[model samples]
Target chain A: MADASSTAKYEALHNGIEPPSFKLPLIDNPEIVTANTLKLVEQTPDARKRFLFTTLTRYLHDFIKETKPTTEEWHGTLKFLSRAGQLSTPDRQEMELILDIFGAEALIDTINNPPKDSVTERALLGPFFTEHTHDVSNGDSIASEGKGEYMYVDGRVVDTEGKPIANAVVDAWEADDTGHYDLQYDNGVPDCRGRLRTDAEGKFNFRAIVPIAYPLLSDGPLGELLLAMNRHNMRPSHLHIIVDAPGYEKLVTQFYPSEDKWIDSDSVLGVKKSLVVDLEQVNDVESAKALGFQHPERGFKLFKRDIVMRRKVDA
Target chain B: MADASSTAKYEALHNGIEPPSFKLPLIDNPEIVTANTLKLVEQTPDARKRFLFTTLTRYLHDFIKETKPTTEEWHGTLKFLSRAGQLSTPDRQEMELILDIFGAEALIDTINNPPKDSVTERALLGPFFTEHTHDVSNGDSIASEGKGEYMYVDGRVVDTEGKPIANAVVDAWEADDTGHYDLQYDNGVPDCRGRLRTDAEGKFNFRAIVPIAYPLLSDGPLGELLLAMNRHNMRPSHLHIIVDAPGYEKLVTQFYPSEDKWIDSDSVLGVKKSLVVDLEQVNDVESAKALGFQHPERGFKLFKRDIVMRRKVDA
Candidate 1:
């Protein structure tokens, strides 16, 4: 009987009579979604962190809200995402680089590790960082024997107060002259890279050839996107380094050559002025012997700087 | 040789640098993408009639943007789309209803064929609307052949200028009281719906059982989403009509029952106040005689509505 009455109503409406309409109960405000996000944040238990979480969540929401793609475009996106997964391997860690390129790496890094104070500077862990490396002597060359120009990088690790941190660890790595890593070498020789723990006076030094500016991997879809934008895909001449100590913070940073053309256009955007220093030429025999150079005619270079790290509370 | 020299130059720089670094560029003042219907107008060459096209494009984009589904949510979307395609058939056109639910049907009707400035209004071509239908006489009943409520829908097709549109083609269709169309019936009976052209004085009348406000097919992924949202999948009671004439403009619109509860929460946001009517009930021997009703004691209802179609050139 109920069904029959409903049937009659449908007939009355479908045959000719019009249906009624109503409007949604929404406020006349500009920030509708922001208000909603704030409401959602209130659902969380932690009151102190609610504002930060809401900010991040709302930012992400706004990011996706604008770049709305169709179902077909979504299919293309999924295909691209699957390829990202397929490209990840032990030898070539492209996933980390992808995260860096998309700014997710920076975002996560900012949240996971903030600066100790307003004066301290936070750093990023770049893609080329590896877990382990062969430790070399202070004066011994870390480069392939007789490969390129001899570089003497001497540095002392210090606290924020400028006091030398005895036994600080400065692990460094750099590509060979051909822009190839030690692992990428087919001949089973590790490239010019090593880990050298600072001495008793917080002093650390290594001898290696400087690395030339090289283009990032430019065969992927990201590379195509860069090419379309007419942007160069090269990082300027640089050396990767990580300084660590018990009482101070670990600083993951890079040193870029001042004259490299690609310095202004480093694709990964990793360059700092404080990290730049000149390696003065040494033609004198006495000076060469002090730095352990055999041939007096064979010119060598001397570089000296200090690594400063922020001191953490617990450390 | 060029590569080798460049490599040497980099080495010389590396040997010369103390600890190379520079100020990192900040990614401040980030811009969020804001695309809407206007984007299509800007990108497309044919900007004159971009209204409907951009509406459709923005509709899809907004749906995807508002529902920021994770990768896992896409599977449900794919399944729902697959079922939408599966629901389509040659004789039974469920695809049209799917389009109606998506507002595509009304959009196409509004764009392709507009109502005349002085003629009667038309409704959308619904899923139950089959091409082949036997035109009945003034007193003929469509419910005599189908199973539904005993209803008599009588109305005249009039112009927007308060004049009767004589001999206008009025195509009509509606589901049974159970909200099921004739095609949903197991037996192959197509007489449940029919077409009746308005008479010379712009008077048109037809007899059919009332259709119930029924829930749409809710077994698919869209259904699941509806259920998750705690929303019923039913639409308000409504009728479909298509008024087409040579001198007058074509109008396609739905007539909705004024008392329909679902009007407040229409799934597709289709119901409009201008389309609703009271659908008055009446019971008299004289009325039965004039309308050719067999059972005067059973009573009948009157639904009167005038469709206003826009003129050709002005529209």
Candidate 2:
């Protein structure tokens, strides 16, 4: 058992800050409480910190006043938040998933990376993205044979002015036909994910399996919240890609297949009309053969899109 | 080491809920994201829950839009919250402490339990309260000898109209003069805290140590937050008490000594004007002897107040 007095040591140390010079009236009412809190927050020396906390306090207090949650409900909310944190792991980002499901992540992403004409809109950097992807050469397959049906993804990285940007690093990841990422399996190896640098013409192509729609974790607090809200926890099938090049704003985006059933109601609110693309089924065996598919006779689905990035100065 | 595949098991289980029939417009912008989230929240069958979540979504989104915290700041927030939960134990409620320091708890309490005429206002039931406490008779000392300077507390539990409430239970607890609760010590036994019943005349009196002003735990995320906000972490000296009786609302509150230097600026925003009381110094040896102090010559501080409880119907 843990020692009960473990927290006692913290009680002895002070933050070394003295009381505020201004006198606060007794917090006899709710308004006084808010006023006093804001007054104290104003003491922050950093302008950005002060503004962020002041705004947060105002919105939080407004939420409490408008919702008027009972004591039990408030306690339950706190318990749920704590459980979300406790369930989070390096691979399983339960807290971020909560923010995603609640649409907060989407909102923040949208605000920070606002849309620019001719520049690809940013999307949520989901919990599945990993830096340990295998490096593959052009026209190489990101997935091993038999992972799923054949799919060829090709795209060109270019500036908003339509100039190709050569040697741009592209990282792509997606769930397999089983609706699970490579990291979800016990094999402890990166699969159905790869990193490749664009050729001299800013062109890149990778052979992969067809991505499948999947559900977020349904056993944790996020699942419970979705259930309570009477919403499905399924995300539309999409391929996540991040492109980076010097002297340009990094582009983080996703390509969603328009035909997916959950395309409109992505649980994370990550979908955009501009990002959705149609996959063409090409039955030509020669086309699959040229793409290095093991079963050329089965043909392959072709996905082609050109990514537009903005310069860092423009951003 | 924990198995990496432990979370994979949860991935296979879906929430068993179908997508809503309504078509959410493509979430191409921040406005659409917030609109879709509120729409989804409206699907909740429970009226109260729907209202609460809808309000919460609005304020949360508004906060995000107003503050526009950078991606790094947002991630930092999630990490801080997760650390708070990880550090919390059965005895240490780091999550609630976060809410307290942020002033959310005070606002919730104020809104949910609005004050009524002739009734004592409630205060925060701080994290130090425990279920296990010693049962002491009236007029007996709650603290052991040498705990602190002698103090005699006398109070009556009465109705709003001043009628006596016989057999009412009064639970009293406080930190010692050294600014620590019994639970804060490693002894693992209750001290400086007790539960007692009122007499037929609705009178209750107890002997205890003089409560001392103290700083809150300053080694956790809460401390970091206070330091960042440029605020102190001190709570004024106060005795915690809970009075319960038949056909009346249970009162959870604290009595702050008016003379304490920190009385006006409670770190948790718990102090109220009506809850403040003055401790009368009694120097007469006979008075101290009658109150059962070990050294009558040293005398004792006297705290006397009558608690007015609102009836259940009135509340």
TM-score of each: 0.47, 0.92
Instruction: Give the per-residue lDDT of model 2 (tens digit) for A1-315.
Output: 226553454455667788899888987688998998889888888999999888888888888888887889988988888888888877677878887777888888777777778998877677789998899999999998877878899889999999999999999999888788877777678889999999999999999988998988778898899888888889899999999999998888889988788998888888887899899998999888988999999989889999998888743
Q: How many Å off is the CA of B102 in candidate 2?
A: 2.8
- What are the runs in model 2 whose C-alpha is more than 4 Å off? A1-12, A131-134, A246-250, A311-315, B1-12, B130-134, B311-315
lDDT of 2 by residue, B177-222 (tens): 7788887777777888999999999999999988998887778898
Best by lDDT: 2
lDDT of 2 at B314: 52
- The digit string of per-residue lDDT tens for model 1 on A59-159 reads 43443344433434433443443344344444333444443333333333333343443223434444556665678878777786555666778878777
Which one is best on DockQ? 2
DockQ for the candidates, in order? 0.06, 0.59
DockQ of 1: 0.06
Alpha carbon lDDT at B225, candidate 2: 90
Candidate 2 docking classification: medium
